[model samples]
Target: MSNQKTSDILISEVGPRDRLQSVSTTMPTAHKKQWIRDLAAAGLREIEVGSFVSHKLLPQMADTGEIVAFARTLPGVFVTALAPNLHGAQDAFQAGVQKITIPVSVSEPHSLANVNKTHAQMFEQVRQIIACRNAHYPAVLVEAGLSTVFGCTIQGVVEEDDVLRMAHTMAELGVDEVGLADTVGYATPLQVHRLFTRLKHDLGELAGSAHFHNTRGQGLANVLTALDAGVTTFDASLGGIGGCPYAPGASGNIVTEDLVYLLESMGLRTGVSIEKLLVARETLKQGLPNEPLYGFIPDAGVGKNFHYAGEKA
Candidate 1:
């Protein structure tokens, strides 16, 4: 019932950041800029351009700051980037990202492995980032993206209570939003429904996007479940490319093109133009010529009778 009408859903494209960071080949900065422009033209309002981590850690994201600066010039686009800690957050803020997402893995082993910091240490870092934002960049939104909430490849079976506790703590820490991530792609539809239902109940307006991976091929199903649970936003990669480099065997986020087609077909108003999205996909391919792109809609095409949500029928 919550998602019955033509609801406006946000599909936050993370290909420029998440997918690129996972690959060995670095996309040229010019090509990256063009890809982002094409994506924005497709009506993707929010885009995670890149991460503000060290060049040594992720050279693929070395051009994040430049990308952020370029993306900010585009009207009506909410530019975002990932920041691992206070230092990265500072860099991201300085680069003029309207929003920044900090990964906070729920599993202890994952927390240690991903960022080399325990939950307590990460919380401290988050606190510092919040103080920095409040003092200087008060307009920038800081989002805590809770990773590996469904299950972890490193630790396996993250507890729901732990996930809720982390979200509650993030809300208390003055974070703008807290989102749940299926980092290793082990979630089923029922699990997604139950967990997101609880997440929205606990965090209310602070409950943010759903980041699902198609690693186990359940991504779209999980999205439907989350939609029913009142999630209005999702994080997706352009070609179903991307994985947690730290979380082994975790590959393929939900494809943005397919996600748009799915949402539009369901009478959900995502504001993305599928025709333009396909063109953007071509640009992504041009940037990363060797990479494989995945999407059923891209391959099969929309049928003759299909109409986008809210279209005159």
Candidate 2:
């Protein structure tokens, strides 16, 4: 079964959308465009360019449409965005995002705080969004993300049944896939293994990507669990720049650099060049000057004995 699973890993870059939304200062559109371009040049096939939230609240994502337009020009790169509702989905479709991800928290308190909607209400929103996408953008993939699947900062201890139901609900609503997210970064490896295994049992082909946070230092461990359960796609941020700003210290996603290094050393093909990924981190630091980046691989540097694919040892 492991051999039958995907031999190549798909790293879906989320820095432009997630990282910028977290920082105290807003990144300029030109910088964000260059960041996106540099990441694509580093061989990231899929990227979550931006979110379609209110500019009044998230000024950083105000240029989501423009970023999406710019990302589309890069051949072989699939542009993705986060849309909370039908309106966002419409905007995403107009901007030509190839995929749209909508997050619905399992914890009611988290859900209300994040989107001001209940899980049920959010499910309806996803359904409506899916309908609209099917009518106008049939090729566009709709990803329903179940946030706070393990625990929540606001409510705490989300039930596994809620996650299963959310996955089933989204799949029933015509979503292309359903993802599990560690929004507050409280997932353990055991929990990761259990949830994803159970979720796959319930959701089948609808089991989507893994969106883990490095809040409590268990980000990569959670990814390992997901891999053991047959997950091939992952969401990561360059330099680990983006995470739940509300949850301090939980400031990075699983670093794209580190995850790639882990996968590469373990014999999985990620199709990313570590040198290019590291070079792109410079653009990240430049974009968010005051933001402190996190990643062990970047600090430690690649070992002398390390050999990436297509590179001689």
Candidate 3:
């Protein structure tokens, strides 16, 4: 059975949205719904089900509205979606997402390439999005995910000062939270620690989740660093199956199963069932049969003496 206990950490699963958008194969709406159900059943309270992007631009996410509708039916699950602009945010609000994450790239080049907007324009869109949310869906939460905060594949060597400035701008625009994303997987542990520490010190309650990619095999190390820096929320994928579609050479998010095991073994309660998470991974594989899945715990299996954080040893 899934754990009924509350968690000390929040693992926001992003496989359905982030992973699907990057892949060429479009998972059917039914399969997407089933995958979400399985993930929630494994005790993932927050799930980024899909994005509110154009079908022509991202055909894989064409059924996002339907996915959101289905995910809303699951009890105790917080449904979230990515919305790159005012139009997408409006669609997401209408679709009933509990939270909307807007990617605000810290790198100017990345911002232009990802959403075809400058920093000022992106901030303006965020203002409009917040205005629309306040005027209509006051209950919906808005988060500005600061993409390429670590470094950019296009721009290269994004400054920490610039990232802090963008995050502060988003906060000033009325976002509920601001998260740092290693969009191209260029983050190191020391860099992650220093930035996140500064972010927490600066933003306090507004400092949000850590989104890391395993492109350089530093994802887990970065996670540990962020956790030590007082970050309790994290973003991971079911099978490490996500990367920035717009960021070249970026591949794989930190795997959900491994992340759960890491936290649980460290005596941090994530409230996720590793066995059930593995089951959810199977559901993911069934949806994208040809797609390659990555994770260590899935291959190695848990140790004989393994136990969940809150469980009696």
Candidate 4:
């Protein structure tokens, strides 16, 4: 945990990739860099800068390599990117990312719909990614981003046993971590608690970040449950900007600013500056003024006499 505050929670900013990909208007590469820089300045230690997928599928992330290089120049920032297969993972590692996240959906239907791969094929890809990473850049961490661990939009009611089985399989395959994602916002607090608790029990330190969508407005509530279940790392977006393109009902991710407020107000340090986070939100606005951004903390302003327990801005 040398890269993070031991006493504080780690918030991984995913807006640059997750948010931009869902929109039609490609965010300017320069604007993306500016937004990422501002986010790092706001005290976010980890950020998923972009995804290393095909340009045909996601033109917005065409410049992920350049973005990764730019993000590396920032001090104290750990840059991560999404890689759907071995090729993407190799490209991401060669581009100099600190970590790579390869998503594998627990629900077979969702996996096929999202990545055009079955569970077996996706697991094989993960194995290849791990082998490639080990052979080339052993320092680069490879994480299994378990998507649709909750119920899936395409195939509803994903079983808990499937989630656990896949998580254990990822752990057995030598993934550095396994993150649970609520791909369609079908997860409840009790469900989140039960699932994450079981995952932690199964994988221990390998059970990683919690990613939730606010489609039903339960994103923050789910985060609370994950925290109680002993999850420290969380994946959130700037101004609440994210949703799965493959999942119809999926909507925005848990808003980073409000999540930080929730953690800091409870005296759990997040090492983020709420005031500076709002400034970063403004940077996002200026870059993509037409896009709608969501967050309550920015609208209501900081509470009267609010004191941040983390590092001061």
Candidate 5:
């Protein structure tokens, strides 16, 4: 179940890919490299470095291959990238990403609008991508992410049964892991707990990271519920800088700095150094000055008396 060997809670940094893709301003490649290095040095063991999609569609991800290459050189870092379809998965494989996440929306309309493929078509693409990985890069892991599992902006109130069915199908298809994503920030803590609990029961070791948005300010609450449901891995942005491009009204992922603060304060070990994380986030700010960066911990600073879990006071 572990992707890396260091932490009790694995905070997978998604700012480079997820945040950069959503924003209009593109971060320079060298800044991205430094930011990722700083993140790794700060004790983040896993990072979603970039996406392997068409540059025409998302020019922000144009340098993903380079970013993946750079991220691979950092010791102890597991580099991941998002691949929308079989073609993008192949590109990711060729680029040598340690893991590839392919998002499939349980909401049919969302699936179509996001990737221009229906859920059934996406299923086929996943099969093809897995086959390609098996034939060429067996060591690389493919994760099936159930985006919009809670609800969809395009078509609201996504069915829970449909999500379970798709997760079951993904497990059957041999994906390394299956995860739920609150793509449009439509999840409540109760819904997150219930759905994640069900996903764990259905997928067992395959139920993976929780990707939540703070659009409605329910992201941390959902994380608490997911942890109660036995999920450890989480996807977060450095400065709370991302949202789904196709899912309207989806604003940003939960801020990584704030999430780490909460986790460490609760005695759950995340291994990220809050001080260094803030420094790394400054790199992000410098890279994309026009884009807004959000985090509670950064503004308020760590408590003078607070110490991370296991640190001697």
Candidate 6:
């Protein structure tokens, strides 16, 4: 089979959106641009460049359009953005983002609080957005990411059946894929394995990309569980610069450096350089002067004896 015919892991770097949103100090736009360029140059094929939410709402993402345009200049990279509503989607589409992921919370309380819409209203909105994107920007792929699929801080446990129903609903509404997010970082390896297995059986090809956060220190464990359950695509932040604004000291999403190192050590191909990934952390410091970044790889220093398997670019 051709390489194109084979399925491989698609790691969508979400540090710009997920990680940046929680921090108070807005990152420098130039530093953001250079960090994105460096990541793309280092071989990440897809990156979530920004979110189309209001500048008033998320000051960290005020330069979304500009960053999206800059990301487009790089070759062989799929530039993506998060569109919180139809207006955001339109802005992202105009910015030439090839893909837009619109988040819809599985937990109704989270949905109402985060986006000011109920689950039914959000699903209907996704339907309209899908129609709009299909008619106007046919090249763009819309993924309805069901956030808090595992558990919610405000809403307690989200039922697995509810998640599958949302996935099916999004698929029926014509979304390209349905992504599961472990918002608030409450997912464990057992839950990840069982939930992914259940979603695979129910959602089929539409189920993908386990989004994990290291809030409770189960990030890499959940990642491994998802891999065992046959999930390939993953959403991780660079430098582990993520946390819930409401939940303090919850800094970290499965660090891209650690994930790459784990994959390489297991003889899997991630196509990312561990050293370059660590070097990229310098941009984190520059972009976020006061922000404290977290990750074991940077703290542990990749062990004394280690070598990256990916071909250096």
The candidate scoring highest on lDDT is: 3
**lDDT by residue for model 2 over 130-173, one digit each (tens)?**
88987888988888888889888778778888788878877888
Model 2 clash pairs are: none
Question: How displaced is residue 181 in candidate 5, in Å?
Answer: 0.3
lDDT of 3 by residue, 30-100 (tens): 88899999999999999999999988999999899988998999999999999999999999999999999
Query: What are the models' TM-scores?
Result: 0.97, 0.95, 0.98, 0.97, 0.98, 0.93
lDDT against the true structure, each candidate = 0.91, 0.85, 0.93, 0.90, 0.91, 0.82
The list of candidate 3 runs beyond 4 A from truth reads 1-5
Residues 1-313 of candidate 4: C-alpha lDDT, one tens digit per residue:
1276444789999999899888888888888899999999999999999999889989999999999999999999999999999899989999999999998999899888888999899989998999998898999998899999889878888899989999999999999999999988889999999999999999899999999999899999998999999999999999897887888888889999999998888778888888899889999998888999998999997787677775454
Instruction: Give the alpha carbon lDDT tens digit for every residue of 1-313 in model 6.
Output: 0011122566788998888998788888999999998887667788999899988888989999999999999987888899988889989999999989998888898888888898778877887888889889998988888888888888888998888888888888898878888878889899899989988898788786788998888998998899999888888888886765543344578888888877766656767777777777887778887877777787887775566554342
Residue-level error in angstroms, candidate 1, position 153? 0.5
State candidate 5's TM-score: 0.98
Q: What's the alpha carbon RMSD for model 2? A: 2.7
Model 4, runs deviating above 4 Å: 310-313
Stronger candidate by TM-score (2 vs 3): 3
- Model 5: runs farther than 4 Å from truth? 1-4
lDDT, residue 138, candidate 1: 95
Clashes per model (N, Cα, C within 3 A): 0, 0, 0, 0, 0, 0
lDDT for model 5 comes to: 0.91
Inter-residue clash pairs, candidate 5: none
Better of 3 and 4 by TM-score: 3
Error of 5 at 121 (Å): 1.0
> Which residue pairs in candidate 3 collide?
none
